[model samples]
Target: MLKFDIFLSALANGLMTGAVYALIALGLTLVYGVLHIINFAHGATLTAAMFAVFVAHSVFKIDPYLAIVMLTPLFFGLGYAVQRFVINPASHGNDSNILLVTLGLSIIIENALLAGFRSDTRSIDVPYGFSVIEIGNLFLSTPKVVAFFASFVVAGLLWLLLARTDTGKAIRAVAREKTGAALSGINVDHIYAVTFGLGAACLAIAACLLMPTFLVNPRIGNAFVLVAFTIVVLGGMGSIAGALVGGLIIGVVESLSGLYFGESLGQIGIFLIFILVLLFRPTGLFGAKA
Candidate 1:
């Protein structure tokens, strides 16, 4: 039998890590739902936010958390403008073209970061980086706990915004059916911009929260982006709840695979699981039928 103690510890860590993955997948799903765009640039946007926080800490001596609060709105506006000027137009016709454009955007951002920061892995040195909380035989790192809680709070707020507010309802309407939303007097373009902006804002939030736990580098986003895509595919394309559940599921599976099968095969094992899910439930657990 599997040891209960070890399983509980692994489960805690998996859920905590999964919370971060869920945050990343949330943004991907939001963009896909509203704009029908895969947003290859989402990860790059997140890298940019991480770099922004790093700069604030290194140059201005500001707390990383405080810097995130200050920088989020700026990145949110940047996302809105990018969608309004570039992405929104391409979204209307030939989605492949839009995908290519975003791919180019991702390349541009990554290269720019390489040019500016070099190919070095950097981290924000926060005072709490070494802190942890222990309960019984279980121990939780402060940074991971914070990241997890922040993800939950952000997800909750997003849920409330979508379910309770008029703007949220408008966005939901557009996501469900753009033509019907337009017929009902919702400005489709504005809703699209808002959705993209919100998605990008979530990326910024996730980047900031995760920086203390992981090393920051231009290429780091590439790894997380792949995982995010897997989460989105497994959860059901454009399904928010699926993103949350799928992220946790993947995290636990990976943790267990690493413990039993070894780190090299862990990711491969997850991919195998993903393939099986596709073979059985092509639409994903929560995805709408294509």
Candidate 2:
């Protein structure tokens, strides 16, 4: 009975945490999907949003969740500017430039955050942040549950934005074939900016939702990037649905590994799964080879 209880507990916890993981990976997948550019700076974007939300909460007493409304637009603008000035200019050159530039950008952002935030861990305080709910033999962390729900809402809305909007159609067209999209008079470059902006905005949503659940610091990006990258590759680089499912799988496996072995072993388990996936299904769960 105790073993069964532990198993159930691990499963529940995994599902909750996995939801947020999926949200984090979603932005990464989207950017790569549309722009064909693997954004090595994605983790920096996550850290930046977390810091922005923390500052807003600290100075204005605004709810971290509420601050996402403004941060989303602000991030979108920043992303658009980045894509326009940096990524676009590099697009004309060798594809390797995108990789190197984004990698350098990530380092720059991390150091900037270290200077600004002083390497202290910061988090938002909320009334229900540490609360938990009991159902049968399971215990649910309140913040995790809330973050999970928020992730689902954002995911659904993103699906609509991609599937329904005319702008979305253009973005999809560009993703399918950039040259064809330009030939069709869709302004492929502008669509690239929009897609990058949308991806960045997704990070804001994920950061805001996570503010109550996790601590943020200059190294937080470094901490989570590995997991996020694994989830992205597991789900097939740009497939949103794949990200969601892959997150759940990774979460459960991680939880079980920690429960059975140890926390350090859990990290090894993640890589083991990642390696297996790469060997057998490099294209990923929902991704088709381009």
Candidate 3:
């Protein structure tokens, strides 16, 4: 039988893990909400960011935390350029074209990483990598705790951006009605690029937070893609708060299920909830009725 204290500890761990998952889902949701395009390259972009952190650490002697400051804007710029120059031109306002372009981009990125770094799994040896916090009979990883809090901070800042900033308002306007937004003097294409950039920036931050605790390889980011999709769908297609709450809930469920059912089998719990959510609440927990 699992001890109550152990259960609590697992719950805590799940929340932390879910926070990162929320960050990943936030990027996906943002893009979907605004552009209405499912960015298949999102997972590859995340892998690229992880690799960016690793290279920054191993080659340039930068700390993972410190790399966040540098990588976030860099990724934002990359995403912007890709959306503006590559995806936009290639997609030509067609949904099928957009899907193909993003899917092709993902394949290109994955193969490029494979060719450059080979197939070896990589991780950094942070000075505080093994540090943990103890409270009562429970122990929590310090990196995870930091990630948990930082994820919320990022999400809050995102909310503030959307709720307060001019750029955010423009993005939201474009999301609601691009033709009206463009007629209102907003640069719709620029907004699309900006939204894509913001999504990539979120991934950069998530990657930095994950580096100390997670392993990285060319394919590592693919692991989060399905779960992120689940969170995005479960939270609703385009709801930010939904993504946050749904991620935490999924995290806890995954952790508890893992504890009782074992690690490999634990993943079934997430899909089960996903299926149930689809069958009963197709619009998702936070999604509006269509």
Better of 1 and 2 by TM-score: 2
Error of 1 at 118 (Å): 0.6
- Full candidate order by TM-score, most accurate first: 3, 2, 1
Give the lDDT of residue 242 in candidate 1: 89
Candidate 1: RMSD over Cα atoms? 1.7
Q: 1-290, model 1: which lDDT tens digit per residue? A: 34887878888888888888999999899889877889999889888888988898888987767766877787878888888888768656678887988888899999999999999999988899879999888888998998889898988988899999999999989987889999999998888888888888888888878877778988888888888888999999888898898888888887788777877877886788789988998888899888
lDDT of 2 by residue, 1-290 (tens): 98899899998888888888888888889988987878888899899999998989888888877888999999989988998898779767566788888888899999999999898888888888889989988889987888888888888988998899989899999988878888888998788888888888888888888888788998787666789889989999899999888888888889999988887887777899899999999989998895
Question: Tens digits of per-residue lDDT for model 3 on 94-124?
Answer: 9889999999999999999999999999999
Deviation (Å) of 271 in candidate 2 = 0.6
Report the number of the highest-TM-score candidate.
3
How much lDDT does each candidate structure score?
Answer: 0.86, 0.87, 0.95
Task: Give candidate 1 misplaced runs (Cα > 4 Å).
Answer: 1-3, 90-92
lDDT of 2: 0.87
